[model samples]
Target: MTYLLICCRLLLGVVFLVAVTGKLRGPAAFTAFVSSVRRMRVLPAALARPAATAVVAAEATIVAAAAVPVHAAGVLAFATAAALLTALTAGIVTSLARGGQEPCRCFGTADTPLGARHVARNAALAAVAGTGLLAGLLAAPTGAGPLAAPVDPALAAVAAAGGAVAGALIVMLDDIVALARPHR
Candidate 1:
């Protein structure tokens, strides 16, 4: 369970870090993201910029909270991550139902339009966050200190490596699917 928690924490942290970086990469990138938000039509046109900014801030917060070694912080971070992903998923679903074809700005300037795959991705990530939250809560000890118990070095290394690989795969999922499709 400890190793599982470690893997989940690292995975969420890496994913959110990549996501936040993608949006904050430059003025042009963020502007594009705001444009994508408006195109999604998830909120009023006037609120697009603010919504985009809030999304990026939330991602950054998840990353920061995941980095904290405290048990309670881990639990809170996972909870926040789950909630954010759920909201994003709902937005995607709404956009799809409205027949919006705007490209997803999720992990930077990807030309992949919103689709079922995007919904599945967000759902899967939310599940991971939920699982991490459960693990953290279940592992808590009565009167535990601020910091979590130290994990075995080898286990920690393995968990971190696994999480990194998973994060990379998720970030590249659209490209992976594109490559797998039959070229006309």
Candidate 2:
């Protein structure tokens, strides 16, 4: 169970790190993200820049907090993740409901257009965060997850590989869904 929590932390941390890096990779990417936010219409055009900054800052904080192996940090990371995911889901829903057609600049560029899959992905991420928080809260004193020192190298390696795979799948969801669609 401790190892599971650590893996969750790793997976969640990697997800945020990737998002932050992809979104901020260059001026063009950031500009694309701002444009997507404006298309969503969740916030006023005047507020898009500050909102983008806030979003990136929040993601960075989640990555940093997730890297800490303390029980409290895990809880904080999960809580923040869940909240962030909820807001993202809402934005997606709003865009879809309003018939806004634009690519989701979620992982990187706006190559992949927004769809129900994006909403599903966000919901899945929120679920992961909720589960992580519950695990932290249920953990015993002195901690058993990442806080339980002396993690085996082999175990850690396996966990890391798993986290990497999970993160890859999430970031590639657009492609995955596209591939799964039936062709004429």
**Number of the top-ranking candidate, with lDDT as the measure:** 1
Candidate 2 ranges with C-alpha deviation above 4 Å: 143-146, 149-153, 182-184
Best by TM-score: 1
Residues 53-111, candidate 2: write the lDDT tens digits: 88888899889999886778888998999999998889889988988787888877857
Candidate 2 at residue 121, lDDT?
90
> Which pairs clash inside model 1?
none
How does each model score on TM-score?
0.95, 0.89
Error of 1 at 150 (Å): 4.2
Candidate 1: where are CA atoms >4 Å away? 141-147
Clashes of each: 0, 0
Alpha carbon lDDT of each predicted model: 0.90, 0.84
